[model samples]
Target: MKKSLIVSFILSAFLVTTLSGCGSTSTAVSGSTDTKVPATAKTEKSTTLRIGYQKYGTVNFLKANGELDKVLKEKGITIQWTEFPGGPQLLEAMNVGSIDVGHTGEAPPIFAQAAGTPLVYLGHEPASPASEAILIPEKSEIKSVAELKGKKVALNKGSNVHYLLVKQLEKAGLKYEDIQVVFLPPADARAAFEKGSVDAWVIWDPFFSAAETSAKAKILADGKDTVANHEFYLATRSYAQSNPETVKTLLEQLAKVDTWSKDHPKELSETLSPQLGIDVPSLERAAKRRTYGIQPIDDALLSEQQKIADSFFKLGLIPKEINVKDAVLPATK
Candidate 1:
């Protein structure tokens, strides 16, 4: 419930109605044209591939460039992108079956799996720890994590920064309840921080970058000492299984995009800055922290993620224990 807590428990037993269920989900493949369909149907139908993206990520760039849509269009596919403020909400849309493919941080899917929402991760983005962090007002006296006790912090529930907050508190030997959590979306949190409504904010870039530039926030802690919190490309179990072709296409195109972003970060950032209405320097700072590459799922990453989930459970944050590896798709060799 509290994003800035030492452990994450986002509706572990509730929101079971969603499709993030990794344990057992859909078996249908992508294109199921019926032999039962009146063999003489007149016009062919195009698949409306609904994708969800968060701001300042691969999906947003794809949408801004219109390249994914263009490439998929050749296959008679229609791309419909829905932008979310952060991962938790993006995964929420995916769970309800409205979004065919979505991207989110490491924590949301783990939380979703704990709740039995039907989702299977196809793969992960290159690891990037710098994208998320905890910030305090520049004028504040919060010199260390220990000072956070009894203070209020703002963060988006179930996002990657939520996990960062948890790990930081644990390192400080503090429980989540030691501080008050002000759960807020990025936009509202920004406004509140400017007005001093909350004591600190746990967030991701470009918001983190934005706050540094526009609001002069100071970094209290970051993902560097915690987890890499890789971005994941995921879909309903049924969707990935059914539309392997679509997923494959998406993967290849995404790999290319990731490569381009990595090789030409400065150019890319300069191009993307104003398009997103973020300051150019802010985008540059956020870009340097990103590492873009594709990797097959490995046991090491799964083990690390398990620790995160188990920590949440051990802290009484979640009602059910989660098996992190059970949800990971087999490594694509």
Candidate 2:
């Protein structure tokens, strides 16, 4: 009987030790799970940021200076800068996921929106009215915006300068059908203008300034009294929505570079001239014409953007109407 009791006690002791060990392990696991992980610690670090830039903008300036790379390096973010001839092409790249963010004039995003591209407007450069203009050969007989009627005018269709041409025509009391519109990109338009194939060229700088300096082009009218010429920064909707922090960092860097560029136009021109293959003087003039104040898209800006969209739709530039506010990125999200 004692032997039987001793065996039973040994079995009980083994069971108790095993159960206690399991309970201790369970407690440890629960404690580990209960510990909070920091949001920053949990976030997956973004390694590369793909940026689409024009030859003449804050993004280009940042690329030229390597400032953005320096700013983002500590966060494990590296910049991949891609140059687009124009905003329309840049936004197209964004739609295809080739680029994560882009800098463009106001109109390309409108056209992109109409085309069902999922893009969001994150921010805007301040009004730069003097930077874009409709130019005539210095010796040409055409004197005013009214004279553009019945004359062939060249501009990149759906470009910001397109809006300037429309607004200038309206201000001159001319209908859209009154003029012979020639759709051409800046390079082709410059070629046509220089070769006297096109009577007038509506363009934006550094092309505008380059034409003035190199081609001896005369300004019929610039955006000063016409368009606000608000440059926009855009991102793919998926990227903007999913990676708000990354977008914010990009905007902040852009703003910093803009501020620096505005204050140091000479330095900026010197730095960018070789990179852009444009002369320093023209670049200096172009740089001076731009405003460095990058602002958040707000009600007043949206109202202006809406007018642009509605005008384009009515003029048959776009297939359908769109709400500018629909593409605005929420300040937080």
Candidate 3:
């Protein structure tokens, strides 16, 4: 009987030790604060950056050369490129979560912000005022901006050219209401301009150069003395805040390309010609007048953007007044 009791006692001791070890493990896993994993550590990082680009710009150039991909690949980030007809369409895609980063002109962001799209300015290119212009037919009777009064003018609405058209009209003593504005993308506007459907078409290069060279369009007025045609780089507010290093890498790559492009106009044009489906000469003409450099957002630049926002608000182009500074990227620590 004692032998049997001793065996029972040994079995009880074995179960107690096992149960105690299990309890300790359970406490460590479920109850211990020091053993808990951080919320950030549990989150996964993004692996792809979706970019939106127009037919012509530094972004397009970057895509054409395929250099950005190589640079980003080192960091395990891949790129997805989407071609947009113009700035408005690109920002629209951004609003719908179709794209993460994009390039646009001065005016689209203003309209987008007024409509409450969550975008943050990443950087800007120097003002290339001569890059965009108001064009008439080779033989059109309209000689100047004032003559465009009461005539139908074609343009991509909310594009950089929109502000150009507005400022040019103001300078020529014509109100915004004085002209009939036809809203169309670059391709459609080009067709309308060709078929005499519109008297004037306001556009940016290399479309402007194409119109001048192939379609024989004449310059009615450019943004030279009117508006600062600054091109901006932007990203969705969420993407920018989450992936700042990727954004920085992109800007650095763009800067390198811009520097090379400025010094090698002929090569740059030739490189972009096949991709754009524009002739080399036309691309060259566009490249010649382009100012190449990317700059950070500053108070002076923001002030200029604010003037555009105010002008657009006064003209009822945007629904409500917006502060341009609110769209700027938060300063880094």
Candidate 3: the clashing residue pairs are none
Separately for all candidates shown, the number of backbone clashes (residues 3 or more apart, or on different chains) is 11, 0, 0
lDDT of 1 by residue, 232-252 (tens): 777775565455556666766
lDDT for model 3: 0.82
TM-scores, each model vs. reference: 0.84, 0.84, 0.86
- Give the per-residue lDDT digits (tens) of candidate 2, residues 205-225: 999999999989999999996
Please give, for residues 103-220, the per-residue lDDT of candidate 3 as tens digits.
9999999999998888888778889999999999999998878988899999999999999998999999999999999999999999999999999999999999999999999998
**Best by the lDDT measure:** 3
Better of 1 and 3 by TM-score: 3
- For model 1, the local distance difference test gives 0.73
Best by TM-score: 3
- Model 2, backbone clash pairs (residues 3+ apart or across chains), number: 0
Worst 10 residues of 1 by lDDT: 6-15
Runs in model 3 with CA error above 4 Å? 1-44
Which rank order by TM-score, best down to worst?
3, 2, 1
